[model samples]
Target chain A: MEILALFGDFTVRTVAIGAALVGAVAGVLGSFALLRQQSLLGDTLSHAALPGICLGFLIAGSRRLEPILAGALVTGAAAALLVLLLTRTTRIKSDAALGVSLSLFFAFGTVLLTYVQRHAGAAQAGLDAFLFGQAAALVPRDLVVLAVVGGGSLLVVALGWKELKITTFDADFARSLGRPVVLIEFLLTVLIALAVVIGLQLVGVILMVALVIAPAAAARQWARRLEGMVVLAAVFGATSGVVGALVSASIRGLSTGPVIVLVASAIVVASLLLAPERGALWQLAHAFAQRRSLRAHRVLVDLYRLAQDHDDLDYASEQGMLDTYFGRRTGHVLRRLERRGLVSRAHHMPEEGTHWVLTVDGRQQARELIRPFGERDTTLDGATQ
Target chain B: MTGLQGWLDQPGVTIVLVGALVGVAASLLGAFLVLRRESMLSDAISHSVLIGIVLAYLITGALDTPLHVVGAALAGLLTVWLTDVLVRSRRVKSDAAIGLVFPALFAVAVLLINVYARDVHLDTDAVLLGEIGFAWLDVVRVGPLEVARSLVTMLVITLVNLAFVVFLYKELKLATFDGMLATALGFRPGLVGYALLALVSVTAVGAFDAVGAILFVAFVIVPPTAAYLVTDRLWRMLVLGCVVAVGSSIGGYALAVAYDVSIGGAMASATGAFLLLALIVGKHGIVARALRRRAPRPPPVVHVPEAGGAP
Candidate 1:
């Protein structure tokens, strides 16, 4: 009831809805950005948008969102293009280019912003708020801008999935198919700028980078196909947004962006460790179990070989001999094999140590295993002979 | 008498010195970072160092303590370590891992700041955009002369970084250009890289109160990057990067004074101005390359002596 009561607040509802839209759109676009290895571009573009925001404000002579966002998109595209140009033409590597563009454009913007603050009198208010955005500033009217841009970008992605997918996974292949690789790249960069600017008012620039990256990275762990990844990422992003919005609203006066970023990062952390097949923890466990079974299987085969060498079906090999043969302790491996009914422990004499002998079932299993190696390495007989 | 004392006494002198010192320190380490293609690491380290500063402050209940820089160094190393873990796990790519780790640390730091903000005067805005205008207000007496504490701090950091660069020049050059060879030769390039980033972290923390994190990142990356475009030699790059930084500091201060804007911000922007200049004039620059491309290509000539063997 308390949670429901909180959501009933108009401001909270609007902010939550807006944040969800921002998350979903960014998730879809960020997948391609990640695959392109241009994840840092989001950071560059977002920071680079500051000057455009200032210029737009100056031109419009108002605190209107449309011109400001327009200006942001323009500079964002320019920064992206500049990065591409530096990488293509000069020896400037992408990371250096990114750092270069990010600092320069942000520096330019900061300079412009301070300049605006001094000259524009009181009219130039709330601009500094963009540095760390106030999510509570989200009004009902602004959600329309988010929805139109977010929905339009989503629509474009749906309609051009084939071209986008080909270009994303393999640009040269797409170029071979006569698709305009350069144009598609430009379009995607623009879409990314769109995704970044959509939530600039709610999340700010620094946190926007995290939003674009975290959800998609988490989705990568679970999804096998591009479509599935896109959908899953969107879901993850939306969930982070809504949860963060609620949590921040519940705790009075806390900004929502960092909270949202923490939630998204939390999701990524969980997905990395706990996802079924691709998860680190799951793979670690799988590898551990596989190694254990492999050791046990090796011990089983060694016993069978010993029996065959001695020309006795029930030939016993001392554990010490087996240990030296394997060059390690085999007590645990022998015990495990025995537990599996693959081997049996015996004593030849009181003065001698415990010995291992293959059981009937173990011999049969060993024969099954040995048969594969024999078949696969049949050429080995010819080579040896 | 407009001698050194009078000039130094002006607020402008302190601002430029503070900016220039921070710039020199950052550019020294940033050259290697740029060459290794880990330039973005500065961005990540600067953000994550906030946690260290906040933790140190929380423990000590004061700002500008030596523990803050130590804590920041540890935090910087922690970010690199965590990013390495994520990459090694094969769960996430390196960039994503970096993106994930730093933001998580930054978010936690911000939340801590917000939660404990009432008890302390640690304003986030001030931390984000430092007040270099007030640098001369708080002065520490060094002998008969009183100096701004930030200037002394930046001076020490600059010297430390300079010593690191000078002492380990060969090691850094080898590691930056050929990491595997360095590792094979038992140089432990990875350790050197971490030590380098740790100092970067310490410098970023030290510079935080003067230029803030964003501008610190600017100083760390931009000047060296500008120098990279202009020079082929490593030593030239180091000197050129410092020159770019000092120039930006002086020029930006003048611009800031002229327009009445943020002095630090203008200084950072001035690096871009110099980079743009480098782009047009450097040997490997855009203009030179374009001019060459526009010129006619020469015919491929075959040497008579080697032609028979080649055929």
Candidate 2:
């Protein structure tokens, strides 16, 4: 009932819905950005948007969201183009290009921000909130803008899904298919700029890249197909935004953007560790299983070799010798094999302790395991002889 | 000489000197980073070091101690380590790995600041765009002399960086060009790479208080990249990068004074402006290429083979 009442509150509804819209849009667009290896482009664009925001405020002389976003879009696009131009025209690689643009544009924005703060009146009071966003300041009008931009970007993605996919995965092939590869790339860049602009109000400039990247990255871990990735990313993004907003609202002094980013990051960490197939934990488990099976196979082969050398059906190898062969793991492996009826342990004199011999089934399994290494086995036999 | 000494004694002079020292130290290590294609790692380190600073402050209960620097350096290393772990998983590409790790750590730092240090003046804005103009106010006495604390720290860091580069020149060069060969020769290129980043993190921490994180990245990457375009030799690149860093510092200060803007921001913008100029007019610049194309080609040699004709 408390949660329902909180959701019904006008201010909370606006902030929550606004954050969710930004999150979903950023996530959807971020999938393409991540796939293209332009994950840091979001960082560059967000930082690049600061000067534009300042410029917008300077020109409009107000804190209106429209002019601010328009300015942000222009500068964000310019920054992206600048990065591309630098990398292409000069010897500078992409990483250096990105770092240069990110810092330079942000620094320029800082200068502009300081200038605004000193020169402008109290009307520009909340302008600095764009640095580390104040989502609590969101009004219903902001949500309308978010809806238009978010819906428009999503529509563009849906319309150009094929072109974007081919262009992203294989640009040369896209070119061979006579697709307008350059045009498609430009469109994608513009879309990314739009996404960054939409997100600036909620996630802030500094933490906006996290909103664009973390959700998509987390989703990528769980999904195989592009469609699935996109859907999952959108869901994850929306969930983080809503949850982060609620938590921030409930908490006394927490800011919303960092909280949102942290929530998204939490999702990413969880997905990386716990997602089904590509998760790190899954990979570790798979490797562990493979290692165990390989070790068991090795033990079986050793037992079979001992039985062959003696040419005795019930010949038993000393536990001491097996211990030397398998190191400290000999007892564990032999016990497991005995349980499986692949090997039988014989109780010997008190001084001799334990011994093991492979059953007929174990000998057959060992031969089958070595069958894949047929050529190598003859060389091993020669060496042994 | 007396007039120059009087100007030198002013606080502005110390600010510019401190900025220049940061520039020199950052670019010195930055040259290697640019060549190694890990320039963005500097970006990652500068941002994530906030956690280290906050942690150090929390533990030591003071913000000004050397422990902050050490903590930041360790956090920077941790950032690299975490990124490496993510990359090794093969689930995340390196760029995405970088994007993933820093924000998480940075957000944590921000949250901590909001919760615990609300009353303290540890403004996040200050961390982003540090006020180098106020750097002169914090003075420390060394013997009978009073020097700007940031300047002293930067000077020490610059010397340490200079020593590191000077001593490990051959090893770093070999490791950078061919890690396998370096390892075959027992140079342990991996260890050298880590040591270089350690120094970079320390340099970042030292510069962060004076120039802020964004400008620190500009200092670390832009000058070295500009130098890279203008030169072919690593040693020359290092020298040119240092020269560019210092020039940008002075130029940035002049611009800041003229515009009455943030000094650190102006400094970083100056670095960007330098990079743009180098990109246009350097040996391998676009303008140079265009000019070369426009220049009349030498007439095809119509050598009169008099001796051959006679034969």
Candidate 3:
């Protein structure tokens, strides 16, 4: 009931929906950026938007969303283009080029922001919020602007999905197939700039990269295909946005952007540890299971060799002898085999330890293992000799 | 001589001197970083060092102290270590690994500032774009001489960085160009790399209170990058980067005064301008490429060549 009431609140609803839209768009677009290894490009674009936001206010002379977003788009695109130009024309690599553009543009923006604050009256009060977003300041109209821009970019991504995939995975092949790879890449850059601009008011400049990257990175761990990755990223992004907004709204003095970033980072941490196939935890468990099975197989083969050396097929092998063959793991393996009824352990004197003998089932299982490597089985027999 | 001495005595002069010192120190380290292709680590260290600053302040009850520098350096090393751990886990690529570590650390710092140090002067805005104009106000008296605190701090850092680079020039060059060879020769390139980063972190912390983190990055990366474009020799690149850094400091200050804008921002912009200039006129620049393309290519080998070939 409390949660529903919170959602029913107008400011909360607007901020929540707006954040969700921003997250979903950033996530979807971020998949390509992450896969292309342009994760820091999002960082560059978000930082670069500060000047544009200030420029937007300067041109429009008001705090309206449309002109501000337009200004942001212009400058953001310019920053991206400048990064490209620097790398292409100079000896600077992409990382240094990106760092140069990001800091320079942001410093320019900070200068502009300070200028506006000193001269532009109290109306410029909320401009500083772009540094660290003020989601509570989000209005219904702001949501409309976010949805239009964010939704439009999503639609464009969906339409250009094939071109983007081909170009991202193999640009030369795309060119050979006559697919205008450069133009597509430029368009994709524009789309990413648009995503960054839309999210600026919700997530702010500093933390916006987290929103763009964390969800996509998390989703990459779980999803096998690009399509699945994109969808999962969007879902993770929206969930973070909505949850972060609700928590921030309920709490006093907690800012929205950091909370949203922290939540997304949490998702990434969870995914890294828990996701199947690729997660750290799953890999560790898989390795452990493989080791266990290899150990069991080694014990069974050892037993089969012992039976071959003795006159009787069921001759018991002392645990002490097996320990010499298999190390300290011998007792554990024999006990496991006995539990499975593959072998039986006979208790002798406690000082002498136990004796183990293979059952009929164990002999049959060992024979099956040997048949696959029948010719190679001679190697094992020779090693024993 | 009196007039020049008076000009040198002004607070503005102190600010510029401090800025130049910071520029020199950052670019010195940045040249090696750019050569190594680890320029982004500077960005990572700058951001993550915030946690160090806050933690240092929290522990020492003072924002500006040697402990703060130590804390920041440790945090910078932590950022690199965390990035390495994430990459080694093979769960994420190096770029994403970098993206993950710094922001999380930065967010934690921001939150700590918000919750614990709200009453203090540690504003996040100040952290992002420091007021270098006011740097001279914080003067310290030492043995009958008064000096701007930032200027003294930056000078010490600059000298330390210069000494390190001078002493390790051969090892750093070998390690940067070919780590395998450096290691095979028993130089321990990895240790040199870590030491370089440690100095970078200290330089960043020294400059942070004056120029801010992002602008510090501009000083660290942009000048070195511009110098790299202008020259091929490492020694020349180092000297050229320092010149660019100092030039931008003076030029950016003049622009800031003329326009009444943020001085640090203007300085960063000036660095960007220098980079743009280098991109156009440097040996590998677009203009040179265009000129090479348009130069009359020896009028394509004519039928005379074809006749000789036939013979």
lDDT tens string, model 1, A1-385? 2666878899989988998999999899989888887888988988888888898899999878888889999988888888888889889898999988888888888888888899998998887767766677788888898899999999999999999999999999999999999999989999999999887887776678888899999999999899999999999889888888878878875677788899999999899989989987889999999999898888887787777767676889999988999999999999888888888988888799999888879987877788877643232222343
Please provide, for model 3 over B237-309, each residue's C-alpha lDDT reduced to its tens digit, 9 standing for 90 to 100: 9999999999999998999888888888888889988887887887766777789888988867654565547
Q: What does each candidate score in C-alpha RMSD?
A: 4.0, 4.2, 3.7
Q: Please write out the lDDT profile of model 2 over residues B40-130, one tens digit for every residue.
A: 8998899899999998888888887889888888989999999999998888899999998988898899889989888765678888888
Using TM-score as the measure, name the better of candidate 2 and candidate 3. Answer: 3
Better model by lDDT: candidate 1 vs candidate 2: 2
In order of DockQ, best first, we have: 2, 1, 3
What TM-score does prediction 2 earn? Answer: 0.90
Q: What digit string (tens of lDDT, one per residue) describes model 3 on residues A1-385?
A: 2767898888898988998999999899988999989988888999999999999998899899899889888888889998998788666798888888888888899889888987788888788888878788899988889999999999999899999999999999999999999899999999988988998888888888888889999999999999999999999999889888887788766668888888999999999999998888898999999998788878987888877766457777888888887657588877888889899986655778788888878977877777787544433333453
lDDT of candidates 1 onward, in order: 0.87, 0.88, 0.87
| True contacts reproduced, candidate 1 | 0.73
* Cα error of candidate 1 at position B247, Å: 1.0
What lDDT is reached at residue B38 by model 2? Answer: 93
Say which docking band candidate 1 falls in. medium
DockQ of every model listed? Answer: 0.71, 0.74, 0.68
